[model samples]
Target: MTSLTRAEIGALGEQLAVEHLRTLGLVVLDRNWRCRYGELDVIAADDATRTAVFVEVKTRTSDRFGGVQQAVTPDKVRRLRRLAGLWLAGQDKGWAAVRIDVIGVRIGRQRTPEITHLQAVV
Candidate 1:
């Protein structure tokens, strides 16, 4: 089998995360939204709860670097919060709740990739 580049893996992970979110009924608002500070992997809305979800996707082939869960550090969460605020500020609509989420995608090991989503990381 051929190996995938880091960018390719990350893209696949984000796509999988989007699909997973859609299956859970969240409507995707934006993807790869970027600003000077940083980039937001996925932005989705939970219409039923009137909530906006900001997601950070981490893709990995193995757990050598402490796995995906350990990838989002406290500082990273702070940055994500700031980025989320920046994104929200540009919206004309309001949300009852806003949340930060982390989605971990692990591929190339099993027949199907594994996805782990942690919501409300704040």
Candidate 2:
């Protein structure tokens, strides 16, 4: 059997994250939202609160070096911000109250899925 490629694995992780977020009451509005600078893995809404989320998903097979959240570098965050601006430009919606979140997912056998959510990413 062929092992999953990095992109494939990342996709799985993103899928899991979306499902998990849904379970927590976040309504997913978009996936793989992108622009010239970077991409946001997911965009979700809390309808009652009228808040939109720009999410960045990071996945890893292990924490041999560090967990998945460790991958979100300052540069990466900046790129996400840039892409988010471009994304918002196409919208009629206001983003002043929108939220940015980073989700870290680490996968391994026998370990419950590790998920960390960082809201208001900065």
Regions of candidate 1 where Cα sits further than 4 Å from its true position: none
Q: Estimate each model's TM-score.
A: 0.98, 0.86
RMSD of each: 0.7, 2.0
For model 1, residues 6-114, the per-residue Cα lDDT tens digits are: 9999999999999999999999999999999999999999999999999999998988887766899999999999999999999999999999999999897789999
The per-model lDDT (C-alpha) reads 0.94, 0.81
Off by over 4 Å in 2: 109-111
Q: Please provide, for model 2 over 1-122, each residue's C-alpha lDDT reduced to its tens digit, 9 standing for 90 to 100.
A: 46889898899889989988898899998898766666779988877677878898888886775764677788888877778778778888764467778888877643676788888877
Scored by TM-score, the top model is 1
Q: After superposition, how far is residue 26 of candidate 1 from its true place, in Å?
A: 0.2
